[model samples]
Target chain A: MNLPAGETRELLAAEYVLGTLPPTARRRVERWILLHPELAESVRRWEHDFARLAALATPEPPPARCRRRLENFLKNERPRRRLTLIAASFWRYAAPLAVAASLFLVVVLVERVRTVERPPAGIAVLVGRHGHARWVLTMGHDRMHVVVVGRIALPPHKSYELWFEPRAGAPMIPVGLLPNRGLMTARLPAAVYVRLAHAHLLAVSLEPAGGSPTGRPTGPVLATATPQAV
Target chain B: MASPPEPALPSPPPEGRSEDPLAAAFLACRRQDPRGLEKLYELLAPQLFGFLRRMLPRKDLAEEALQDTFVNIWRRIEGYDGARGEIRTWIFAIAHHRAVDILRRERRLVPTPDTDLESLLATAPPETAHEPLAQLEETRLRDCLGRLSQDQRRVLFLAYYHDRTQEEIARRLGSPLGTVKSWMRRGLLGLRRCLETP
Candidate 1:
């Protein structure tokens, strides 16, 4: 589609800078700005002009807790940076190991194809402390199908719960409770679906018979799995 | 590694109040100084939080946006080129973009029935009176905004302050989407012409 001409183009840029363009249009303009210097210049000009409008709003200081939150974030950031570097190094050394593991997982998945209903958008294999796969999670269109693959033993009145971490260092959201045997399906909420779109990790925590009473996990984490899109 | 020692925390000045402190804090942030990040947050948080509170629907969302804005500023400080524009503008742009992202993700970009456009226009006069050029720019903006028809001004205000999309603005005003788009375009064009005039 042709870019809006002359005055329309400038106004579109103004809307983009003002943050009113719909997602798709905003994304299209973002790509357009990269290819068109004039569009990019207009965006920059509008950014400068609209920056003053921010002053038109009353200046209310953020709550005091916000400072404490920032302090905690900064404190965690340094260690996370180091962890990222270590992760990079680990990926370099463990590349072949990960490839082998992926091939093994594929073979297992192929063998279990008769049990799975449809093609999965993503999958994760949660393992126990002994390095054995305890459960397999397959993400479908609007549900997560989980299958217990290994023998699990739990104390009385205890169950395992699933949690999804959309991004590293972000809080984990409780997905659902894990079944000790047989298949279980957990429906996904729109918010959860949005979060799962960018999720990288899944974990299992031992909880009460029903699930975590609190919205958050209240038990010791038992296992973690790296979620991968198929 | 040990974190850098933090300097004393001074109360943040009002919006458009002090440039030197913000610039200094920005420079410190560029150097990877924690103190600078602290100072920058102190300096920018008040105005940014207020701006975000108006842009987002909920107080918690505004607070999260404010926090994310600082995180982005800290992470991307190395990429910031001073030649392009003032750091304050750049910071506001970051916060605004973050707010939009949240609005889109949460699907909160709906028509807000109770947005008081008149009060929005009446309150929050720029605190830049001490700085003649900034005050002049603010005055020119207010003047140019005043020149537009109420429809045009309302469209701009809803989009800018309330994060309303054109469709939402149309719904809010009981007008056609095409009409809302024209109002936005004409209003922006009129403001540009007026502000650009010497």
Candidate 2:
């Protein structure tokens, strides 16, 4: 389990490259490679050996959306300390204004709901990588209601951050960090709501407990969903 | 073990070359040149996409894995050491890992087909008319791969291309678990020897 020796190590390296190793054994070998330089060399050799076979596959051009997405990701990945500082200032002034705006919107939304019986404007069921529905978001006129339908175990120090990805080439806007469980309402600002109206997809990524230190996502994106009219 | 009869494969085209540009791009990416990253994508995305397409069941899923692979490569590029292996191998490792993750996730949702092994093994490799490799490398690899026993070839193909676990392969092929493991080990060993010779 620690460090495989001799022929065993070579076989393990090959199996690892071959994708036949079980998850546990695969993790063990990966860790072993980091600790022992010789094992790493062995794995590299095996990787090169099989790489030739990879060429046998017919090349496929990825979808146009893929290039756009990668470009956007790379753009967001740039260092923007200045932008983060501006965001901090903007949030400071906007927080109280946002609270007052939400209270007024809630009253108006409540009145409208009583006057007319209508379904949610949009609904998105965000499924995790495992295909389990994890979060359900219902878009109202001025607010978005999110419900955690399934439990996503997270490190105590980590949290799930949500973003609204507009259909246009706009950068992903930070929505908010999802609570560990249960329903949480986010009062969407007019700018965000306007963008959300045109947005087709919502993305959720895992970030630090407080949320992304960077203005943009700094961790693995867990799921994405396109909201449907309901 | 006696080698299998070699198939008559056409000489590969001369267009595709080595990984030197990719390696240089990696170096530039390390220095935070965004253009270098874009160049790397242009050079490698097709090859990675091809591998992912065969590995995953759906094209959309393959695309998602491809995106994730590049994102991960960008994030982890700082840790890349050229001395360990070619950037090509490292990139493929990341992509293959991503495809396997998707497969595992999908497997959890639905049971794997028990007869997929037979069907996949029976199917021929897709024709390379549209996408040919370098002539010498292609000829050498095809000849060497053809030399492997049918069982060895099948096992290696399923393992490398489809990301099938030995246990799953055993169930799919209707063979004993131990036999499947032996086939995988022997297949890889045979391939290593065959490729090493000449």
Candidate 3:
């Protein structure tokens, strides 16, 4: 089975992509491709070359139930709550911390009422994919303030958009876009405020520079949170 | 062993259908867009199911493998690198591996007779005989494929479409193992030459 070095590698790549290599040979080729960049490129080219043959197979659509099954699988797997542990810690210390913080805030407010003005009605700590709190969102009577609490790097032409998903069958509503740096404030319309109060979850998704063109979340959901009464 | 009579080759499709949408959908899937997978299923399920059917013995088995394949695709989409290969290739590779796994599992339980290959080949009509290849509409690869000898084509077809190994193909075609291996290598090399010719 001796072949010229290049020819042998090409044949291996061809057979590998064609699914003809036996289990052992397939595994060996998989390893070999990593060591040889040229072999890897050859494999990719063969894959493209043979792709047409795959497309030529008769289109026998899977049973309709199969679609439902896939949908169910994805639905069950997609919306992961990354901040559950943080939320649990928050709840554990909420009572004592709330009492101490409330007393301190009351005293400070008495002295600085004219300067600080109104307090937020609800506050939420959004957590990123790595389970770290990334943003602090505060909903006031007529506006929402979003402050970045952790480092988030976005591509030059991308931005983060906030969304509110109500518990009922209502569709996800776009709240506002978060600033790429520091803090941002958005005036919350009365209708949006009402929807916000009823929202079961708040999510942030990456979108184009301004926001999602579709007015819906169309990118990877980066973080999620649940607002708590202040 | 007697060779099966040749089936008529299907007519070439109209030129210039694009695979861009499929590639875009795959990219979307990688970005965690749920709709991407739905689009992928719409584009590829039928063809994948047909491919699995040729490889597996029963409809239920084929369907099961197809389901498993998509599930694996969904789970591993994030790991896919577009620079490495086309999305179609990545997907078909998954399906082929899954089909092979299923075949191996089934073979352990109900060993297939080597003699059954001759009858199966004789009776099994080429499933792609009437199907139009939308993606390859402009490519001469199909014509090059047609240029292969019947034996070479059959060996290549079973290996590609049915995910058959050289040993299984030999057992199925009632030919010597070494002969089947040589035919496969020659068939692939020949197709490579023909495809590279122009």
lDDT of 1 by residue, A1-230 (tens): 87777987888799888777766677567546644768878887788778777666777889998999898888877622433366675555444454455556556665655654556666677755555567777665566666676457888999898887654443466666788886666775433543454465778999989877655578998877776666
Clashing pairs in 2: none
- Candidate 1 runs further than 4 Å off: A1-5, A19-28, A79-86, A90-230, B1-19, B105-114, B128-135
Better of 1 and 3 by DockQ: 1
Model 3 Cα lDDT, one tens digit per residue, A34-110: 34667778888787776666555555778988888888888887543434454676545543444444444435433
User: How far is B32's C-alpha from truth in model 2 (Å)?
Assistant: 2.0
Which 10 consecutive residues of model 3 chain A have the lowest summed lDDT?
A: A108-117
What DockQ results for candidate 1? 0.26
**Structure candidate 1, residue pairs in collision:** none
Badly placed stretches (over 4 Å) of model 2 are A1-8, A22-38, A80-230, B1-19, B110-139
TM-score for all predictions? 0.59, 0.54, 0.53
- lDDT string, candidate 2, A114-212, tens digits: 532334456666656555556766665556776675466888789999876643222466677887576677775444444454455688999998777
Residue pairs in steric clash, candidate 3?
none
Using lDDT as the measure, the top candidate is 1
Q: Which ten residues in a row have the lowest lDDT in candidate 2 chain B?
A: B7-16
Score residue A110 of candidate 2 by CA lDDT: 49
Q: What is candidate 2's lDDT per residue for B1-198, written digit by digit as tens? A: 322223223222122234456556766676777777888888778878877887787888889999998887776665554555556666787787788788889877764332223343234454434324333454566777677777877877877777777887788789998998887777777766776787
